[model samples]
Target chain A: DAGITQSPRHKVTETGTPVTLRCHQTENHRYMYWYRQDPGHGLRLIHYSYGVKDTDKGEVSDGYSVSRSKTEDFLLTLESATSSQTSVYFCATTGESNQPQHFGDGTRLSIL
Target chain B: AQRVTQPEKLLSVFKGAPVELKCNYSYSGSPELFWYVQYSRQRLQLLLRHISRESIKGFTADLNKGETSFHLKKPFAQEEDSAMYYCALGDTPLVFGKGTRLSVIA
Candidate 1:
């Protein structure tokens, strides 16, 4: 796949429960990102990592926390899942600062 | 803050006909733009980038910083080109526009 893969392709959770989604990349890229795709919002960045343990928040980072303990792995955790947080999540990686990103198959999460 | 706008929610064209998907962006600094496509049951993949200036699958896009537009164009669209196309602006984390669902009929 030359690429990344997201775990738990589809998940159904209840409100106030905690959940974690994993994004694993085999490309050895330095930059990784998490984004949520919604109907009217397109894809909004939730969190991103520049290097191992170096992370930052994106436009829609309020309820999401991310960790990049290794170069090939980035994990996004929802402290307390909310129904509003349900959406399709995508993971991406880029080799260059001005290059196009490659995305993984999305994970569909539903918070009940 | 950077933003990408895809004006048309849906665009339809017959096979062998010309097709264009409009995309506009807002950024203060030197910008980078890209186009991504998603076919049914497939992962989102990069189609092209403005910096490369390369044409993929007979499609090309010119980055217009003046108008902040990077429109995807193809002279003769094929049925295989039907997919959800998204325009993004950024190098690391992107600002993506609501995608344009393209349908090419034979």
Candidate 2:
């Protein structure tokens, strides 16, 4: 499990509202990622952080923003939630680029 | 660009029968492949990796560079193996297949 923890295991919010999902890791992994899982699209990366204050956009990062102020914390925020953003979000971390990632349980977010 | 493809959306096999989950990848350079499984409402867990060359949970995957494939296989399927399996390619941002749901019926 890599001591990964995702806060707000479940959340229901209305469209246009702001929502944030937090991922905390006990291990000081250098790479952290945020991904959303949907039925047919599989898991799409939203954003990732290589180090504290260093972030990059991913394939499906249009509506998502992320921040990492410390090595152990990564935050994903939806500026304004939309119905299409409803899905299960997962956080993963890896100590190195070639190592396998360890995942957090996931946060199920429903935007109605 | 790197991509992973899983042709089957769902597969059904009887207990004690052979099982194979196909995964094909498209990458120009050396690729690292992996198989991940997610049980009902659970987080995705790594099942096996091509480089490790080790069997995990009775599952093994051999990376066929000639074919650009990494397929997971097991001699006999068990009911407990029913889950959603994903094929992934390691890159700057990992690429994942849509996923295949394996159903082991008794």
Candidate 3:
């Protein structure tokens, strides 16, 4: 276990509603990442944080934002959810770039 | 941009048989390869990395730069080894493959 937990394991919401998913870790790793998983596409990066208040966009960052106020918590938000935005979001962290990452259970979000 | 590809979507083998799961990658720079596995109803977890040059759960993968492949292999398969396996590349933000589901039947 990497001491990671993602809140709201399952959620269903309507389009145009704002949604936030929380990822909490106890490992105090320096890197945190948010990824969305879909059939045939595998896992695509959404956003990542190298440190507190330091963030960057990934391959699929449009319509999504992330925040990292502390080393253990990274939050991903969708300003306005859409049906196309529905996906299984996974949170992962690692001590350094070369090391293997540890993943959270993931949050299943559905936008109607 | 780096990309990882697992050509096989599903693989099946009997217990005690050797198993191989193919993975290929495309990257311009030095590549860092890794294999991650997700068991039934379990969170995804790291299986092994090429940098370590070590085996996990009796499975080993060798990174072949010339072929741009990092195929995972094991001498003997067990039912417990059944899981979804993904191959990833890069250091910071790894690019993942679609994943292959391996089934080890008794």
Candidate 4:
């Protein structure tokens, strides 16, 4: 287990509202990722950060955005929440691509 | 596109029985394969990787290039081994399978 923590472990928000989930790492790894876990869909990458002020959209980045302004913090935000956006979110980080990515516990978010 | 496939959604076996969790992957070039496990109320953690060639807690995964598979096997499954197991692929950002839940009964 790596030193990763996700803020707001559980959240319930209404549709049309804005929400942000934060991931903080003490490992100082260069790569960071945000993924959403749904019942039959597995874990789909939503967004990832490679460096400070650098980020990339992943396969399922439709309604989410991510930012990495500092070494220890990575943020995933939903501009406007929707019911479809509800899922268990995960954060991971690694020193490089082929290395094992350590994961945080998870964040359970529900939008009603 | 890179993808991982885990055929079984759930499996059950008695303690001391042999266990196998199948995983297949698709990618253009050489890829790194891994198995991650999560117990109840615990974070997902790495179990093993193809590159390491080492077994953790009596579990081993062999990466077969021809079949594009990395299957986890253990001679005698323990009740503690019961958990949700995920197969993932990477050379870059990872792609994961839906995961298989193993239930071991005493």
Task: Spell out the clash pairs found in candidate 4.
Answer: none
Interface RMSD of each: 1.7, 1.0, 1.3, 1.1
Provide the fnat value for model 3, as a fraction from 0 to 1: 0.74
Model 2 chain A: weakest 10-residue lDDT segment is: A94-103
lDDT of residue A35 for candidate 2: 93
TM, every model: 0.92, 0.98, 0.92, 0.96
- The candidates, ranked best first by lDDT, are 2, 3, 4, 1
lDDT of 4 by residue, A3-102 (tens): 9999899999999999999999999899999999887787889999899999998989999999899989999999999999999999999989778899
DockQ (C-alpha) of model 2?
0.73
Model 2 bad stretches (over 4 Å): none
Error of 4 at A20 (Å): 0.5
**What's the chain B TM-score of candidate 4?**
0.97
Better of 1 and 3 by DockQ: 3
lDDT digits (tens) for residues B1-106 of candidate 3: 6788899999999999999999999999889899999988678999998999998999999999999999999999999999999999966777889999999999
Between prediction 1 and prediction 2, the one with superior DockQ is 2
Clashing pairs in 1: none
Error of 3 at A85 (Å): 2.0
Segments of candidate 1 deviating more than 4 angstroms: none
Q: Write the per-residue lDDT of candidate 4 for residues B1-106, one digit (tens) a residue.
A: 7889999999999999999999999998988999999887577899999999998999999989999999999999999999999999986788889999999999
TM-score attained by model 3: 0.92
Off by over 4 Å in 4: none
When 1 and 3 are scored with lDDT, the better candidate is 3
Candidate with top lDDT is: 2
DockQ: which candidate is best? 4
Instruction: Report the C-alpha displacement of residue B8, candidate 2, in angstroms.
Output: 0.8
